[model samples]
Target: MLSTGGSALIAKKLGEGKEREAREDFSFLTLVSFLFGIAILLIGNIFIEPIVRALGSTDALLPYCVDYLSVSLLLAPAAMLQMMFQTFFVTAGKPLIGLMLTISGGVANMILDYLFMGPFNMGISGAALATGIGELIPAVIGLFYFLFTRHSLYLTKPVVRFQVLKESCFNGSSEMVTNLSTAVVTYLFNITMLKFLGEPGVAAITIVLYGQFLFNALYMGFSMGVAPVISYNHGSQNLPLLKRIFKICIGFISISSILITIMALVSSPVIVEIFTPIGSATYDIAKTGFFLFSINYIFAGINIYSSSMFTAFSDGKVSALISFVRTFVLIVLNILLLPYLIGVNGVWLAVPAAEFMTLFLSVYLFYKKRDVYHYL
Candidate 1:
């Protein structure tokens, strides 16, 4: 995923032939990325049993893992390209384009879900495939549209030099770190759940996490919306307004997080029920998980806001570090420790713990770098 959002950076690097070259280059890069992801899933599927066996997991869980990965092949390209577009639009400060594309893809995904997963009876695999295609389709369209039409930031020279690739990867690391860490934390959640409470524990945690993401999808949009503004203003040395925008954005996130945390606390069961049917143990566990883990937003919102500061400043190192702390460190450590103390229930608190720790670090950094910030 290091190269996941390279399309945008490559677009930025185009000296003359901005859109035409970017479109063509992105088409190739996107295709290659998509193919690589599909290949990973296909090849990874073959080794599922061996990997599970090596882990001493039950055979019952082996099939589930295989099924999940296989189905995920459909989403690989879409998810990858989604990240690519996100970086491009956010870094370029044109998040409206990405937001429009996202909403379209989301709606398309729903339609495909119904057609492929419901009426067609493709089940989970259908759902996965639909979502996968949905992700990549808009990217393809958007890439073409941006390139074919004239724009302020047209791809001047869409050459695929190593320098171009290197820079793209470097610029995209901030977004990639955020996503990769999410995947890592999710794995940690599952592992801790299994160790503490078994399959039911894992299922519950998974559903709760999913419910939180629905709102986060919007938060992601908001963050992307603000990225370019923050970055562009900083580039022009706009400090006061930078602080003002940051304050406004953070204030919005805080209010939203507080509201969501309360909602999660009150309607956790309802939230879980949206994904899992009632009267089943999975449903019960998921509901329980939602109840416990829903308030992670308050902390996560803070971490995300902090990371945006670095991304806006074009400081991938700080962005990555902050992301790693909120995700990898807090999540893994909590999961590893809590289960030993109180059992699977501990996994639910991992997100919040991670968020709080990261928040402390964010505040510390704010004070340490007080003079480094630019006003808008």
Candidate 2:
């Protein structure tokens, strides 16, 4: 949410030829995000046990969760900084740099994960430490670049207008709702699968979700990359340019959705094999679930793009409404009722069903706002 809001505001400022103000807004938002991180850190430290218990951690898993959360929360500020810079870099017309920084962080994470967990035998503590370190590297680099370097959109002394903060929070509410809904839905998925298929069922769902995460990350990257352009055009009232950009974006997302869906279906076995041995119970369950879940990718890309498009246009209410219905209302209802009607297959179908259902709402929103945004 912070990243989306910051990118939109900065892009809009740039479009308006307010470079200095854009830099000020960027600095302000970065500070706000870091403060948010500090708040979460305190909360996590104070309520780690309660939070883990609330997450339904078993007695056997409590110690591990506590250890992981402890170290992870300590670097909460760095995590927020990394997320903000990833988007801000794009808004600053340095998307390639943003991608490189993210990749650097990911590579660091993998290398450290092996060293800490395999050789050092630090278990969950090592995992947490590695993740924190991974988060810190890009964050520190981004901070140094923005603070010390002269760039198109580098940090400056923050000029806090409470109005900017308010606008940002409101504009980013949809993304926040989407993330929170994901957490809730994931918990429900685990509970529903546990009821039907036990620990292996939950493991199967995890494996399938890992694939979903990988594909979704691509969609996320694409959306993030284009959002600044949308915001810039919209702010400048370049209707013709905005229309062209929107068309290309929708076309790209549509093609990518089909490709991702096909890949998910055809490569289900390969994906499952990466996580577990073939012919194992978990592997079989995941393989079957992957086939069913792959259908969601087709519609999910469109839904994701729709929400992001609205955010880019500063229509947060519509974006939040779309996200709330798609991620929470529709998915939760399907998860609760469908499994009862059609068994485990229904569970696998829930996300696909929800995404398909939300696509209609997305289309309506786009058409309804076409006159206002001039994008249709």
| Count of clashing residue pairs in every prediction | 21, 0
Please estimate how well model 1 matches the true structure, expressed as its whole-model Cα lDDT. 0.67
Model 1 per-residue lDDT tens digits across residues 1-376: 3333353343333423354555545545555556766777677677766755564456677765655556675466667656666556654446677778878888888899999977898766777777777777776766665566555443334445565445545655766777777777777777667766688777777787788677576566677666666655665555678789978987898898888778768887777788778988889777766777766777777677667666556566677678777767777888788767876667777777777788888777766666777432
Candidate 2 per-residue lDDT, tens place, 299-375, comes to 99989999998899888888889989999999999999999999999999999999999999999888899999999
Those runs of model 1 whose alpha carbons end farther than 4 Å from true positions after fitting are: 1-58, 90-94, 155-157, 161-164
Task: Give lDDT: candidate 1, residue 42.
Answer: 71
